[model samples]
Target chain A: MAIKHQQPDLVPLFIRYVGAVSSKLSRIHGIAGRDLEIKLGNDGVIVQIGINAEYSHKVVPDGERWTSEWGVTYEGMRGISQPVDHPLKEPDVSGYIWPDPHKPERMAEIKQAMARYHSDYAVMVDLSCTFLEAGYAHLRGMEKFMMDLHLSRDFACQVLDGLNTYYTALGVHAIEQGIDIIRIGDDIAGQNGMLVPPKLWRELVKPRMESMIHAFRKANPNIIVKYHSCGDFSAIIPDLIDLGVDFIGTMQPCGQQVDMAAIKAKYGDKLAFLGGLDTQQLLPNGSPEEVREAVKDVLRSYAPGGGYVFMPGHYVNLDVPLENVWALLSAVHDYRRYPLNFD
Target chain B: MEISTQDGERSMAEIMKSGTLEKLAQAVLEGAAEDAKRLTEKALSESLPPNTVLVEGLSAGMTVVGGLFRRNEMFIPEVLLSARAMRFGMEVLRPLLAETGAKPVGKVILGTVAGDLHDIGKDIVHMMLEGAGFQVFNLGINVEAHKFIEAFQEHKAPVIALSALLSTTMPQQKAVIEAFEKAGLRGEVKILIGGAPVTQEYADKIGADGFAPDAASAVLKAKELLGIS
Candidate 1:
């Protein structure tokens, strides 16, 4: 009902536990990432289509780096794959081959996911890291990418355009699979503010996002567009609303974006929000009672109208106390019903 | 060929008066790398000291960029551009200064704290610190507490900067601080912390010397910590 913009029986939850957290949670709960999320009563299930493996070149040994189809090589030491080399570092446009978005292997997992989970829970297709970030982080590396943005606007546009074209097709395919939400976006903002200037993002990323949403809507009229960014992006909330983003995730409440009530007051009617629990300081250091109180506060502030989902602001890291993690999940289950039972 | 000290100071004053320094600053503020590089070359040719090229010409420009970013007048991409433009000028001065053995303003060791892979903020702070004339040794993402201690010991840096974008990993800042104390290195160096979810209050609580919201402020805090202008 929340997805439909109507008040639901309770506030829904979306959990994105990744990497070290996933491994630890699996060990502690004796269940895997998705299974643990389901066991915790999440209303949605997200399955990553491992397109990276199929499109990637050869997988090296455990300690070696692996190159993707886009020619970005990533070292696996970090929790997430860190791009060490970009395919387009030389700005050699003629030799590069963009991956085939229509490849059958890429859509198989998404299809399988929709088949299994579409009936009981919300199925979200996460087509992530393909907006402006991949154009640089994967294709040209970050530092070089920024230099490219400053020095080579036309080439940068061409790179971002290629990504926009690919993701739109993938999004259209996901829509056909009868998913509830099609997730998009890369980490374009930082703790304090936008990583890309609003003007540059408006020029390069915003239009492409608008086009991608249009493509998704053209395919499925009722499908929700879920956009995710890692840091405080409240500076562009209005612009995101205008871009047809019906939902936002990992609202990592930092900086000026911490005022959840004000954000809900302004855009709650148009946008459904997910992930506001502080993950940096509170979840790891604060006590279980603090975690519980935070969960209550999040629901009180965001769950009032109709459109809000409960979850960690970002991927639950390994260092989060297991007690706080359980507190976060149980507190949501305990307090998220509406007419919210506030004691 | 080098200009005499008197001639260099006079040229710097002349450039400041003629608005050439402002143009250099404006080029960096606008993130025009070519213009920054060209202006630095011209300024050097006009017999300005390398130090003046660094402080007045390049650092002055990035300071404005940082101010705009703090006020939300500028965004990340523009900041990156400005930092890059400043890098172009620094590239000109780096080798020349290497031969002269001119000491850096201060030395710092920086990293994304243990268990956090987010490096964008750390990278920005690193670039901004370089432009500000600090000799920075960057310990890449997912840096452990001991690594910070080791780097501090190796470089004997006066300041240590830690970054974490994940709240879950933020406690590692305190842990890193604890490690410093256990190693008896806490008082030897001032610790500065930044990233999403890091606040000045948190810095105070963690016993860090200061906290900066962005790259520009990070440099200023480093300067303050080192008792340098």
Candidate 2:
């Protein structure tokens, strides 16, 4: 309903299930990952394209850090490998191996997913770590890249150009494959504010994102664009709106004066929001009843007339008690029905 | 690290004035490290107190930077620039301050927890603490609980700061605290934790002394824990 911008029977629920929680659910239900998501009552499914696939490569020869096809290195520690070293850290960032975005077999899994659950669930392709994240975070190392943006705009633009060239074409391909939404981003902000200044973000990241979204639209024309950054990228929400971002999500509730009601009133007509539950505090510490109330409160904020999808801010990690997960979905099932009468 | 062109124009008498110090603070606030270095040298050359140059010029600028950072006026790269300026200013004053036998506000032992290689947040806090006049011993990333305790013993730091960006590695925080508890030093040093997934409520539940949501607040909490006020 919200994704289509029409009134639906109930608010939609989406979950970006990570490995541990998925494994836990899989064990409890004796089902595969996709089957478990269906059984858990998710209305949508994320089809990850580049990350952790066969060509993506998870392990390294050193057994410490794995280098991706793009030459980004990741140190294995947690649920997902965190990017540690960037291959393009030198002054001359050229001549490094860029991952082939046009891999013919890449979309095979996405096609399989579409053949399986496309009719039932809203399929969103996560092409994350897209521009700033792909460029600064994994490819160029965050600190050095951010410093270089101010110190060496030419180098910074070169990195951004490289990312834009790959992701824009890749995003267009995803849209052409009939994916419902294209999720593209990097962690451009911290808990407090923008990672760099918003000015810098607009100067560097915004244009690249605009170009990517443009390419995505040129392919599908009606495809919804969901921009994903973990922290407070709310400052760039307007820029996202201008660039035709339909859904904004996995919102980290910290340090910003996030007026949800005001956001809904202002951009609600243009943009739908997904992911509002505070996974950091409320999910990890709050009781089941608290989780239920949080769900209702979030629904009240985002699920009014329409244009809101239910999800936690980030992955439901181990810090969150299993019961709370049950409560989260249960609350979504109970109060998320249309006419949303929460007495 | 570009020095302001105006630095050469200031006379010795004017360099000793509060106006000169204010400009130095402004330079640090703007993250002008070279300008900060030149001003520190000029202030010293003008026979100003080394402590005054550090406190009034550099530290005062960092105080404003921290405040701006908290208020969301300054972001990461901006903060890094200001920190670089503060560090450059400190580089000028360290030798003189060592001769004067001036002490830091307190000592903080810091690390990213075991199995978590994330260090950007920890690095920011380390820089902020050092800028705020605290002696910090950073133990780097993927550090175990026993390693934290070992560092605490070696440094005799008043505060131990732990960070974990991953939920899988957050248990390492609890383990480190438990190790401190077993060592009978849990009460001796204040334990403060922060990261992406960490919460103040979680900190309270885990018996941590405090929780900082960001680096600026971490510095303030470190001071508050050590009774620096």
- Model 1: runs farther than 4 Å from truth? A23-30, A50-62, A78-80, B1-16, B95-102, B113-117, B139-155, B167-187, B200-207
Residues A138-210 of candidate 2: C-alpha lDDT, one tens digit per residue: 6777667766776678988887887788778777777788889888877888776677788888888888787
| lDDT of candidate 1 over A226-334, digit per residue (tens) | 8888788887788898988888878888766789898888888999999888887788778999999999998888899679988878777776878888888878889
Q: Positional deviation of A144 in candidate 2, in angstroms? A: 1.6
For each candidate in the order shown, give its overall lDDT on alpha carbons. Answer: 0.81, 0.81
True contacts kept of 2: 0.57
Alpha-carbon deviation at A280 in model 2, angstroms: 1.0
Interface DockQ per candidate: 0.55, 0.50
Per-residue lDDT over B101-212 for candidate 2, one digit per residue giving the tens place of the 0 to 100 score: 9888899999999878777789889988887888999999989789988898799997999998866677788899999999999889899999987888779888899999
User: What's the TM-score of each model vs. the native?
Assistant: 0.89, 0.91
